[model samples]
Target: MDKEQQIAPSAGQKGEEQHAIDVGTGEHGDGGGGIAGDAAEASENERLALVEEPGKKKSTRVAALDAFRGLTIVLMILVDDAGGAYERMDHSPWNGCTLADFVMPFFLFIVGIAIAFALKRVPKLGATMKKITIRTLKMLFWGLLLQGGYSHAPDDLSYGVDMKKIRWCGILQRIALVYFVVALIEAFTTKVRPTTVRSGPYAIFHAYRWQWLGGFIAFVIYMVTTFSLYVPDWSYVYHIDGDVNDGKQFTIQCGVRGHLDPACNAVGHVDRMVWGINHLYMQPVWIRSKDCTFSSPRTGPLRTDAPSWCLGPFEPEGLLSSISSILSGTIGIHYGHVLIHFKTHKERLKHWLLMGFSLLVLGILLHFTNAIPINKQLYSFSYVCFTAGAAGVVLSAFYILIDVWGFRTPFLFLEWIGMNAMLVFVLAAQAIFPAFVNGWYYDSPGNTLVSWIQKHVFINVWHSQRLGTLLYVIFGEIVFWGVVSGILHKLGIYWKL
Candidate 1:
């Protein structure tokens, strides 16, 4: 397949038909001569004709979607590099939304949208499934290699790699799983019949019955499993008392009624049992410090160093919560269908707004009614709804401003970043950039280059150490990667799995 075809499937469409306006030369195609020139001109004419056709859906690429994905990637890098500097920039303690929390959902939502556009172009299911499986495995492997497994000690910064204790799941792992699940659902449910029947405002619903039903089923399953499942209550156990050599002790318990506790919850319990505490995230918010400790009045001491909510260990991106992550991706798939299937720009925008509003209202109702609290750790139904709603609104705004109003000039940089998203992300997170920052250092102070720069430049300039450190890391990564992406884009070097 060609570069456009490869990138199109992974994110938004960027095929020949969907070419963005040439901001540089104010012309389409590479402006070559001979057979290549003739073919490019013919293709451009066909695209223009398609756009001018009344009532026919536009086949051009959605620039706004690419920009949106680019924006998500930028935010992901920023928040990930923030290193928990500000409370609002990190994932919420237990419940509610944070700037950081919104990034993953937004990325997943965009993935769903991309899936719709990508799969529809391919006629064969086998080809689509193969692509999905390969991509999923690639992401899972990288996530494990990069963010998973062993971590360095905070104090001594000692490096250790323990296969037995390596973390099993992480951000890329979740994305892979979620994408694969949603793609499977789409592969089976996507209609073979062309979307010819337009039912006014219900056009999107009528067009995607199978996708809608699949999403509904996934959502229902998520809610039922999260709220109705019975979990063990370990509130009574203060702390385990046993000799290290003997390993014999009587465990105590408070016998709490429900499973919302961190340790006893279904998600955490399953993770601990399957992966072990050593494999789970060692420092979750629920178990960070003494003040964050959980105490059961019915069990032992009033306060214990042990975390109240979590008894053993838990992972936010664990197996159970992945159900909801799939649901989130399913929602994105629906949005993707809207983008591809809908005929008119206005019709698409209207449906997007309606979907956004409906989800926001439903999420609020679910949270307020206490049916399911908006918890990111749990990937609660309410959290999915709210975040998806927010994502829709944000995407719609981008669509309007960038694609609809032809305000593409200002966001060309983002387009550059979007074009080489996975390349930049992997480089920033796993390979070259991070290694360079950590390994390349000055000798005098014996600090990493990043730390030295932050201390000397950003910290010295800003005076407030915390704010300067945070700003330097976040913006420094963005600018560095932005420049790299821009260079790659200019060279027409786009990477894909």
Candidate 2:
């Protein structure tokens, strides 16, 4: 489609500010479009006024970025609420990639891109650092508050709070850590040049050469540390007995040499040593399920039973692996630099595609070499390369279709969700919608609205119980949050952290 050349101007705003590839041209093809556009513009103007110093022109937003973020957020909600109904939608067991594995890396990649645009607008590096620190703390607080601090039996909800067993790290905590590290890198590494002089390819290279080098250095360090680090050998640790000595006699070995087992990996060992087993993820697959048994009516009893390797006491979003996550953010920062440096649409698209393809090829090659497996839990070099490449390509497609060719309306729903991403994420994860859904449940059968809807509506219509439950959770949450985000967008009520 020669879509690269079709750079449609964002109507009503000065044509000088390009919308980027994923952002739609701010032109309205119908009456609803005008109203929506006006509302979005008003919200953005207000946001800029709050963050920006007085008298400076409001920063132009790239709709594509918001759209991209919105899409990622939607998918996040879907997979999260899927509740392991679809095995493919769940994270890969150990050493391979899956559809569910890309979300966090994609979100981190976007954070790097946003940092590039954000820091450029601020005049003082001190102020930028302060803001970054505050946001990082906020993310950490929310992550722990919402996802950590408590563990309870699935069948019982009346247990007392267990202080000794509370988890500390979570999804948002990882994001917070990654964002803090990446922002610091940007603040120190990126050169703040005058806005008048166009940032050419050479200029960008000169400015960010160190960051590129730093990213490479980080990647090498991660590979060496992950593969060479000595970890406790727990290959023989069968079950979690009350006595710690049962699992304490194992020796340590290098992770690269067949030590990637759940209990033996360096990442899990560090976490357990630091946080204790009770403070880590409790229901790791290594813990045998209550219902699982060796015998059945049709089959004879088995000789021995043990915890599955999949359930080893390891946190995918653990501390040690997050170092490689920084590498993913570094890739995003590189993309952000390209977006800011390149003057024309063609230049940006060309560089983005080149970068995307190069990453894809490199990731695949690394995977094939078997030196670094594409493991999401470990945040392996190959995993970051592949996901970052996929993210870049997806952003490019959005740029071409939405910003370049002017296909905007179909994605307006996503834009609304993007506008209040963090706010909606917290709301969806924490109180608002979940409380509402819980309100419908009752002790007796046929009294709860959720069960009735699943049984009659989704199950009856789809003719599959699994599909019905999946749709009910995924679509139900998406639609609920979509409406909430839409109302907030219309009313200009964005809650930024």
Candidate 3:
């Protein structure tokens, strides 16, 4: 992928297709009774993203959807770049929830919701499958190129990775896999028309009940394999560039079943067996935990008494976790169905609140009882419930504020960021934007504009390393990208697979 990637190819198609869509007239006022459309009318290539052009009365995009998506993108950028500075905002080392842990589920949830709108209209099976396949392949390719241990980016300036070391799964890769699965289910289920007598208040559920069943099946598979699969002792070699002791072998003692710790877990074991150790993410989030690092929650040298598995690699977006995460997308799909069936704001919010509350309560029950601790690394059932519930509540709130009351001014930047999510994600969160900036340095590679601004502007002004890094990420990174994304949105430039 380029520093700046492809614009949505369906822009013209979106314009052409808007003629057929009956856009809700409540663009600025209290949302009126919506149409229970047969399905969404979005073009297949840009199915996951539906953006309404400014002042385009017939545009199919919902302001709340864009704003919700934008918010996740901003949080994604914030959490990713702000790691190791503050413990609260950082991803939990293990078995806990933090601000950063919400991004993955939120994105997946948003995708689920988008899938509903994208396939809102009855789609031609051949064309829809073609788009889905192309998009999935593109997402996988980009995921591999951006991550996959190939791109050290501006930090190392290397562009080569040993085939043995290329990671097979990551954030986008997981999204691609889940999107493929969920989109297919939603596509087929679009034929199941809702009926007043059969569904009543549960029409949305009735239409997409297959998705829920699939989710339950996935949950059962995850639970059984997580508890029953035996994990044997695993070993890894460690090396630090410039350190005297670079090559050291470490063996982790497992030889047991149903492990949830970072070292000996079924999730990690399945990933190791399938993808191979070198194909797994080398530096896991757990390395910063108190068990491994000398400075807990901060990336640094290892503790003197670190566990043997501390040196081992773990893939957070491994197969089991990815399967568990499918539930998140399925929940989003349910919300999408609500949008389709419920035309009035009152009905929509009512269903959303009840469902969100139920999920939240069940998640809390599971967590407090130790049935399943909230673990993002494992993508535990409790994590899925809690985060997906939170996502629903937050989205409903956005619908009220942006869709109902028309509070779009304050969140305009977020809207822009959300509208061009794939673009902003690539440019900001993926280090491509920083690398592009770093490409223009004053003499030494370290003397880039980004380094100067962070140090002299944010860091120097704050007068503390921790505070400075935080400020730079918020202002230097987030704010700057917001403006850039806003500009791109204005230019009618957006990204798609």
Candidate 4:
């Protein structure tokens, strides 16, 4: 009695017992509704006590996810804002590697990770379906708007549009298409149910299965179209039927061929018809059967020039390649979700290391087999595997630092601008900031004020076009990031759409 009575008199004991019993409990003993009430009361009393006995203040900073997102947006801004910085901070050589190449894939993976959290908040069935539809439509409209309306450029949608140089599609267009498809998977597939009082069926929709299937199917279709569709083949149920060119091969070439090809009975005719036009103008950046660019040189009979091939059969957003691009984003989301759910450092590291090795090995295998050549413009399956795999490794590293190590860094500068990444990317792509820089305030000459200044004053700057272009683009990027950061700071604006 003496020992128990003496122990019960401790100050912490009094606070703990006072607050503990009144709090409600779930099966796990985690506090419930009553705990929230108790916490509120405790907070109020603590605040009053603090006021009575003033103490030092503590800092309130953003979370690790916020900082990570901030850093991502900064890199995205830098890469997308590049107007003509193709030499310096641009995507890598077709079959090579570069820093800029990882930016888009990183964005996609982050989107996936983000969706894991977002989908949890959305209600099931009716409301969720509606949300998915609305969000998908909005994404589509936003993508189109970002792609810009009909362009005055030669290949841009007019009746007289040039088949060779059409600006038929772009980044946002690809993003929207992928987001819509991936959204459907996230909404319907990855769902959790409370199976029992103690445990529940943690069913992940296995959306990656669908993603892989679609990617492979698209690759197969593309390969068929590239090799067999264009060539004469007749050992199966499907036949070229009647060869009839309806001017479609050339006209629909720039638009939605992925959806159109299988439906149209006149694919062979259309392909052959466009074969001439695409060869003369569109230039195929890649052909299906060719082992290498050298193996099937343009000088060969009926072969198209590499430069022209670069333009035709595929735009960066060609419907076929678009399939792979969307898959890349979807795959990215998969990696992001895995990082969020995985508990241990060793588990994440093991996963990432295995994935890295797999990608590197697969890339090497493809390089030799000439199966799905690792080309960026085409966004080949192997390229997606290699790049996305590499991105997984990097993302795992980020997850470790932000979620496990609990370290924070200078992110206010980036977070201020990154929250609205899509909006910023579209604006920066249009050179809105660069245009402002070229205005009266900094008006001098040479595209940007920075350039003008560099030319006039910093005359001894580097001679490389890549170097000059890099600095020029970076100048615009800094100015853009700065302007947006200030506006966000003043208004306290952070957005998701």
Which candidate number has the best lDDT? 3
lDDT of candidate 4?
0.45
Q: What is candidate 2's CA lDDT for residue 418? A: 77
Candidate 4 lowest-lDDT run of ten: 21-30
The true-versus-predicted C-alpha distance at residue 380 of model 4, in Å, is 1.1
Off by over 4 Å in 2: 1-60, 151-161, 190-203, 234-258, 284-310, 429-432, 444-447
- Candidate 1, RMSD to the unseen true structure: 8.0
> Candidate 2 lDDT, tens digit per residue, 427-481?
7644344544545558853356655766787878899877987887766667778
Where in model 4 is the C-alpha error above 4 Å? 1-89, 148-166, 190-228, 231-313, 344-346, 410-416, 436-466, 479-483, 486-491
Give the candidates in order of lDDT, highest first: 3, 1, 2, 4
Candidate 3: list runs displaced more than 4 Å: 1-61, 195-201
lDDT of each residue in 1-497, candidate 4, tens digit only: 22112112233223222222111111111111122123455354233321111355211111333444455666665665442344334454345445556665555555554543344233455555565565556656655544433232211213233444334455655655666566556556544422111211222223245544554575666555643433222111111235232232222222222222211212323433443323221323233223224433221232343322221243444455556566676665555444333334564466566766687678668866876566665566677777777766665555456444544344445444544454455456444444454554333344555456556433347766545555655564655564675486577443334
TM-score list, all predictions: 0.79, 0.78, 0.87, 0.61
Candidate 3 local distance difference test against the native:
0.75
- Which candidate comes out best when scored by TM-score? 3
Pick by TM-score: 2 or 3, better one: 3
lDDT of candidate 1 over 130-241, digit per residue (tens): 6668778878887887667444312223355678668898888998888787767767665553545466777566667776676677677766665566655432222335
Provide the lowest-lDDT 10-residue window in model 1.
24-33
lDDT of 3 by residue, 193-252 (tens): 453214477656766678888888889999999999999998887766876546888788
